[model samples]
Target chain A: MDTLRLASHGLSKHDQEILSKQLKMLRGRTACEWVLVDDYRSADVTLVQGQPPSDMPGIIALASTKAGKSGRYHLIEWPIRLFGLIDLLMAIELEWPARAATPLPTLSLAHRLARIRQDQWLDVAGMVAQAFQAKDEFRTTVSSFDELIERLASIDGASVRFVEGHHPLADQEAALEPYSLKAVIWSLALREEAIKSRQWHISQQQFGIATWPLFGTWETAPWMLRLAALYGRQPATLADGVELTGLRVELVAAFLHACELCELGLTVKQSTRPPRIESKLPAPESLLARLRRKLGLGYKRT
Target chain B: MISKILFIGPMGAGKTTAITAVSDSEPITTEADNLDRAQSDKATTTVALDYGEIYLDEDSSVLLYGMPGQDRFDFMWPILAEGALGAVLLLDHSHPDAVAQLDHFLEAFAALVSCGALVVGVGRVQNSQDIGVYQAHLKAKGLALPVYATDVRHKQNVLLLIETLIANAELNEILER
Candidate 1:
């Protein structure tokens, strides 16, 4: 394996020791070897805790404040996670030139962060794939919408929640005992749409009146097609539609409006049935909420 | 006041989809089976007009009118254009004669185009060259209307075209006053 010579500047002794241990641990998992060097000029990467060495070629700053500054360096926030550091190093190695005289990697720190994120996403995707493949009760793929719905129905208590943490099939979860299987399938469909838009908060509510007749010539999520098939049998209110379809209220409203435009969705009177009692269990917190708690994304919820 | 916004485009340019995507209510469309397969492969074509309404606020709403694309029905172009806030001219970049189509529509809607009440939305463009061609064409005509790379099927993009048109119209109205 090729080795990378690393040097440090401005970092505390404690941070240098931590970096050394992390380099050793990461070496076992990744192909590149990292070695600490005495001379800054000979080092392939220079980890800096404060001001970056101006003359250095390969500088990796460990401060968030240094982010976006023009320099030949990468920035990982002060408190670095092991995985994030390893990923950043690998990114640099991939981008490094063979000759020392060559210019350093042109990939920006932001681009490296995006690459690391994509790598983590792939890891999670592999785990999800393996989990689904291991399950004998659920088929990994379904050929037809009917087959998909029938298979989903076979799984008792099958509940599929969107990335937003809203369970579109929450109402059906109790009725269907094995909802996790359905959740897996729904997640795959939601993932497909999320990939297309790269925006996760787009719900049926935001989509407004465009979410109906789920199955059409237009490119749409497969889960939506299944939801439309089910809704074709019976019409429900905006709130219940959200619960049953796992789409945001706005998106569902849009679908219903599209159906109305196409004369597809049937008009029905408001249900006289009393509102279903919400579960006493606190709603599952969203990833956004967890991220907000951790990073304080510069805004507060009203 | 309710402002009317006309959506004009050639056959299969997604005019109906754009209106339906952003319309606050169910859009009323006068569509018939397309017998002219040579012109477009779409199953249906707008014969007379397509109508939808979108409220910007409680006090004001925009009425969306989509004119029939075929030149044979050019008679309705000005009729629908009457008393309108602006026009959103959608072009299919994938079409072989898209630039020519732009010129034709620009001539048809010259009144609106001259008055700063028109915004162009070019859909399905694969590269900047297509946009450059549109820009050059508009430049040659001494028009400075906003041109957008859009997917009319997407609500936000369609809304952007409408919003730009409205903003331009308002600006022109203020200048005139």
Candidate 2:
């Protein structure tokens, strides 16, 4: 960032001379040394005219008629502006390992688990961390799963998101409890204690889970497995699931929220199929049941 | 009448022990002196398959087949798993490439995976968090299969894996209906 070295290729000698003179005019204006180097190989920035070199070098300022940012290179255009070149060089300064300013806009995390990337860190204790002065242990009737999204939503939430590398909470990483966005969403969705969420609920539309929710990962009721199996098989509504599992409709609704929140992709059913259709085929003896009975195996919630 | 269930995993992941745990009789194994000692330090390894059985009734029986633990025997996986009720994939968590072994087995037994009839049991794991890693791996591969941390020597632990398989099978049956 100290020396703004510039090198040109395929450009007229007249343009190179003019560019050097223009850089010298802004000597005191910029803190760095704006030197127009003769060597294209060693230059910090390269200005190319017509065709750029095959070998991809450092920051490229393509002198083209095209406006705005191209794929990788910056457009210097027919007549390069000194400020544009300076701004491009300053951007290079911002990219150095020591500097810290790739600001991410803070947004409230509610039922928005899909938006959270795998790399982003979440501080479960948003505003509550300061108000209650609790470290990270918070619980509810639903899930003792850090009380992240639900608690955040209930308290009108304090925004939380740390970038993968440009971490805002890089210093306090170990101090804060970093929960996987999916795991947090799954726990919040599986509010096992209450049949229904206090604040909001997923829509009443009939849907089927695209995949099962790795139920064994959490210490939850065995009923969760039954619920997961049912919905995961085919599209069904809360009402459809109610009679099947003999669980409350609200509880099933809560499960739906868990599915949707975790970005499990619950495929909404089409009109061609009835919501609850009875199989016309005769029921056969379930081999699985016979095998279970043969092995004297009964599922106990482990 | 004979029905089939499978025990599958990488070499030395306790597929034989898991079968013997839940089997009515001692499982018959096709083993030889271990040549791949680098993979696992064991006197013998099942090169072909392991066989055991449980009587469903006085007349009928349930056959338990443990697929060979080597990748070379993957050809027999589809052949044996063709009509399998479901499968229990046992993994040795102590193995550095255990997760990779999981991906390998799950891919080899892609039929059971797609039908949601596969249960994963990771041996030598500590807690739910360790199980979470396996679950997360499955999650990444677009699978929601049941995963447990259990000692295969324990019959109850082995049964639990089978029970989940049965449950998944029954659930698939219900959905088909």
Candidate 3:
């Protein structure tokens, strides 16, 4: 069992004594044992009766009468009770992502890249081999970018994640057959199915083109241009884009999610609920539809 | 409405070929003997403008224009770019001053660039991926235009560049309003 030591600040002389006694009583019963300590620097959690020190690092429990306005610190109503303390500790353990006690032998592609850049871990062969075998969004090996794009076009994009830092599926030899982050994500979005995001909740957030998608060597269509045009006006939800463009909701969702993932810093997150999806677009004098017919954009002419 | 798109870059950046690749018919070009071997070894280069047209209908067409590679004929740029959709700036990666040329052509076409109507296409040099290098340069200059590694001779890449320019043109319409 892990031992979690806690330190207290602004505790009454009698309250500290009671906490010490409570710690002794609750030591062996819980999954994680708790002990009261003097120094916060040496403790897992620190309970402060008043305002917790600003920008404090470790887990902090604010024992205050008022509810927490900033959801940074754990809240414990004063005077703190045994149940509050127990609940706070339990919640902290639950909230933090559970990393196994032992690290995995085969590190992820992201981890390997990080290790190579940070620690200069010289495992290029291993990195290449691991990435080639990657069944997820981390799949890196391709003869040409066009080939990879063709593959992405045929596969299911719903499971692919537009994770930051892992945007470019780069190896040492990626320079020869390189792909832009935009191209990779855009091709994945071609699957035109409901997709996952490493960052945003696709249904819950509004998306806009904060910046243009940096598609290199990847052919774009008129509807995509229209999509960019719509986003250029204002930030909109995926459903809004779908209705206006008459594009697949899944396609728009994945595309918007990819744009956001590229760190274009779109205007999103004002609302948590999904938008009202309506079937409406600009008046029949649509230049995009006309352009499509004249230029053979929607259909492959060549 | 006629939407004219220009392809501008330094000598031998494959502007003529790019225009030819996507043009519906054989493009018109005024090619003269290359007196500047130090710049480009190509036997002939565009002196005035290389013209190609995709006939949209009997009334209108999408005009593909290629600006003269040499800066001496730069007087024709603003004249050609007037009421133009945008321009694609192709770079010959082998040129020693390719990066400098990027800055130069970008500065030359600042109006088109500022309105998000420019896409930079850099041809690859051997096994090198210089897309990031060009992109980093664009980023440093606070330009958000797309930089692509392409062989403009390939119809796919040329078509994509045209698509990108169209996308930019559509985007500019919204942003301007």
The model with the greatest lDDT is 2
Candidate 3 residue B95 C-alpha distance from true site, Å: 2.1
Better of 1 and 2 by TM-score: 2
- Chain A TM-score of each candidate structure, as shown: 0.35, 0.42, 0.45
Instruction: Kindly list the per-residue Cα lDDT of model 3 for residues B89-130, writing each as its tens digit.
Output: 999887889999999988888888777778888886442235
Which residue segments of model 1 deviate by more than 4 Å? A1-302, B56-60
Worst 10 residues of 2 chain A by lDDT: A128-137
Which tens-of-lDDT digit does each residue in A48-71 have in candidate 1?
Answer: 777766687765645554223236
User: DockQ score for model 3, please?
Assistant: 0.17
Native contact recovery (fnat) for each candidate is 0.00, 0.33, 0.29
Candidate 3 stretches greater than 4 Å from native: A1-98, A101-129, A132-240, A260-291, A299-302, B125-128, B172-177
lDDT of 2 by residue, A1-302 (tens): 35657788887988888777667655654445668888788887788887877884777778776334577777754666443454454455455343343332222253433333234444444431211101212222233345444565553223453334444535643454434345555665565432333222233446677556645444345456666766765567665666555566677777766766554555543233344733221123445556756677543322
Candidate 2 predicts chain B with a TM-score of: 0.95
lDDT of each: 0.55, 0.64, 0.62
Q: Rank the candidates by TM-score, best first.
A: 3, 2, 1
**DockQ of candidates 1 onward, in order?**
0.05, 0.30, 0.17
